[model samples]
Target: MDDTPVRVLIVDDQTLMRQGLRKLLEIEPGVTVSGAAASGQEALALLATTTVDVALVDAKMPGMDGVALIRRLAAEHPSVACVILTTFDDDEYIFGGLAAGARGFLLKDTPPDELVTTLRRAAAGETVLGSPAAERVVARLRTDPHGTGLEALSAREREVGDLIAQGAHNREIARRLFITEGTVKNHVTALLRKLGMRDRTQLALFLAKHRDQR
Candidate 1:
C-alpha cells in the first residue's frame, strides 16, 4: 500500500458542511483536503484539474446530486474513489450512490475517527459502509431474495458472488479462493453481465439476497 497521504475533495452544497469536513479530514495524519466544492458541477470543474484519491460527496444537492455525481465520476474520473455523506440514511441514496460506483456510504454524524478511517480504507480500494447503511443493505437483501438472478451463475461464479456479498474486493477474493485477481475480475464481469447489474454494489446485493439458498 502507498504510504503517501490520501488526497480528498469535499462536495456539499452547504458551505459549513464542506468546511467542517475539510477541517476534520485535514487534521488526520494520512489525509489531505485537496479542494472543496459546493455542488457537483464545481466538483467536476475541480476534478478536471486536480487529482484526488477520494471524493467525499453529499447525497443531496440542488443539481447533479451525489448519486449522479458518482456516476459521472465513474465515467470521467475513474481513478478517484467516491464516498457518499448524508444526514439521512435513505435507502434510495445509499443504493443509488453505491450502484453509481461510490466506494463508501457514511452519515454526517459518523465519528471523526471512523470517518477518517473509512476514507483511508476507500482510498486503499476497500468498500466502507456506516453501520446503519450496512444494516439497510442487509435488510434490502432479506426483503427480496428471489430475484437475485443467482440461478444463472455457475458454481465458481456463485463462490465469487458469495465473497462479493460479504464485501470482499477482487484482490481479497482472489487470495481467499486461491485464484488470480484477473480471474476474480473475470468472474465479476460474468456475474455483472449475467445478472444485468451495473457494478459490484448490485452484485453484492444480489448475492446477499440469495445467500440462504447457497
Candidate 2:
C-alpha cells in the first residue's frame, strides 16, 4: 500500500466493458489503468511495450481467448500478474483460468472496493479467488483430503492427470506427451475410473487440490 499506484491493463471484447473498467479503476486511490485492449492478441502486444503490474482479462474473447492469453503472460511476462475478471463462473473457466496462472479470478459483479483490493493484492503476488470460485476450490480440497485413490495411477496416467489438472485438452495432452489423442482419451478414462470421479472437472479439481498441498 505505498503511494505508487498499481498499474493495470484491461482486456475485454466489449468496448463499454473496457471503458467502464478503465473509468472505474482510474478513480481508485492505489490503482491506475495503464491501457485497455479489445482482444488477447492486442493485450499481449500492449504488454510487450508497456509496463503493467496486472492485466485484468475477460474469460471469453473472440480470438486467442483469456486462458490462452494468461498462459502466454505467465510464460513471457512472469512479472506481470494476470487476473480473470469475467462474468462467467463456470468450472471450466474457473479452473482453466487458475491453471493458466491467473493470480486472481473475479466476477464482474464484485464490488468496486473489493475488486480494487483484489487487483492490488494480485499485483503484490497473492492468489485471490472471489466468492463461488473460492468456495468451489475449498469444496474440492475437502472432498479428498488425502487423495486416497492416487496411489493406483501408473506413471503415464499420473502425467496425463497432472496435465489435465493444468487444463490441457486431450489434443494438447497428446501433443505434449508424444501420444495419440485416442491414447490420451484412454488415459483420461482410466483416470476417471481409478479416481472414481464423474468427469474431467472433478479429475482436474482433485489433482489441483493435491498439487496445491504439495
- Which is the leading candidate under lDDT? 1
- How would you encode candidate 1's per-residue C-alpha lDDT over 1-214 as one tens digit per residue? 6779999999999988988888888788989899999999999999989989999999889867788788889999998999999997866677667767899999998999999999999998999999998987787677645534455468998899889999998999999999999999989876765564667897788779878866
Q: How far off is residue 158 in model 1, in Å?
A: 29
Q: Supply the TM-score for candidate 2.
A: 0.70
* Model 1, residue 39: C-alpha shift (Å): 0.5
lDDT tens digits by residue: candidate 2, 1-214: 2788899999999999999999999988888899999999999899878999999999889867787788788889999999999988866566667766889999999999999999999999999999988986776567656634464568998899889989999999999999999999989866764554557898899889886532
On TM-score, the candidate that comes out on top is 2
Residue pairs with clashing backbones, model 2: none
Over 4 Å off, model 2 = 144-214
